[model samples]
Target: MSAVTIRAARPEDAGTVLELTRALARFIKAEDWFLATLADVERDCFGEAPRYEAWLAEVKGASAGLATLFPTYSTFKAKPCLFVDSLYVDETARGYGVGKVLMRHICQLAVERGCVRVDLNVLNWNPARSFYTGLGMQETGELGMTITGPAMRSLAGLD
Candidate 1:
């Protein structure tokens, strides 16, 4: 396994980050929804009022993986939580501890921000579930539901 270094992502990393995200979408069988481009990543992660924060994993000074986190509210906990919006490791870099290093840094950031917990959703078919479980993340056993597109439009009376 190669040594993996994790650090906060910069605008310059947008291109590689988009590539890794697409690769991850392919791995999770959701390539159809992998529509992000370098411009989008750069704007969303580094523009004014940034929507999220990202961490990148590098091996021998080359990007090997990345993770994006969004700030979320936990009403019950009455505090903020960190939601791992996306995580990806390059195919060639899997099993080299890149993913773990990225996750550790995210977790450390969550702690530093005084977040009550860190949360993420994993695909049922993804083998990384075990890795998260090993890191003390437990299944909530609660079904997730979402309303997007037209449903959201109708709810908001915009349609």
Candidate 2:
């Protein structure tokens, strides 16, 4: 096993991050669901007043995985939380502790940012359930919901 390093993702990393995102969508059988482009990633995550933050993981100088997240407030918990938008470890990097390394990095990051918890959404069928549980993450049992595209427009009276 070689040293694994996690670094803040830069605009130039948009392409690789986008590639990993495609891989993740395909792995979850939602290959056509993503409509984002590298420009979107670069603009939203690297532009002025960035909306999100990301970390790129590398093992022995090779891309290993990525973790993208944002800070949120937990009204109920009365503390800040780190909301993980995505955490994708390449299949080839599985069983090599890449996921664990990325997760630990997020944990330490949350602490440094004064966050009391971390939140993320995992597909029900994703096999990483055990991995997350092993890290002490548990299902919150809260139903997740969202409105997008036409639905979002209609809800906001923009349609």
Candidate 3:
């Protein structure tokens, strides 16, 4: 096995990134909601004034995983926070420390950007929880909530 390299994703990596996203969805049994397209990724990840950033993990010159990151503000801390929207290692690459490398890269980036902290969510039933805990990530016990789709429309008085 060749050395693994973690690097910032480029616009051309949209297709591969989308594939990784689908793999993640399937792994979590949420493929039914995986409707995003390559164009959507390109537009959202590399458009003029991109809203998010992504990183790629490559092994032997092949894509192995991806990490999508974005910025979020902390009202109480009054500082910037780095939010990891997703950190997925392909099934073939799971045992090779690929996820850890991606996470460390993200953390280094957060520090460079002057972020106060880095945040990400893991599913309770997912085995990745152990991997996160092994990295010294603590559970703050804060529940993550979402108001999207129909609920979001209703909240906006569009119903």
Scored by lDDT, the top model is 3
Candidate 2 regions exceeding 4 Å error are none
Best first by TM-score, ranked: 3, 2, 1
- Candidate 1 Cα lDDT to native: 0.87
lDDT of each: 0.87, 0.90, 0.91
Model with the higher lDDT, candidate 2 or 3: 3
Error of 1 at 104 (Å): 1.3
What's model 2's TM-score? 0.95
What would the per-residue lDDT of candidate 2 be over residues 3-74, giving only the tens digit for each residue? 789999988888988898888888888888988798888888899989999898999888899999999998
State residue 2's C-alpha deviation in candidate 2, in Å.
Answer: 1.1
Report the lDDT tens digits of candidate 1 across residue range 1-159: 568888888888878878878888888988987778888888999888799888888998988888988999899989999999889888889887877788889888889999999999997778999988988899999876789889999999999
At residue 23, candidate 2 shows an lDDT of 85
lDDT of 2: 0.90
Prediction 3 global C-alpha lDDT:
0.91
Q: Best TM-score goes to which candidate? A: 3
In model 2, the clashing pairs are none
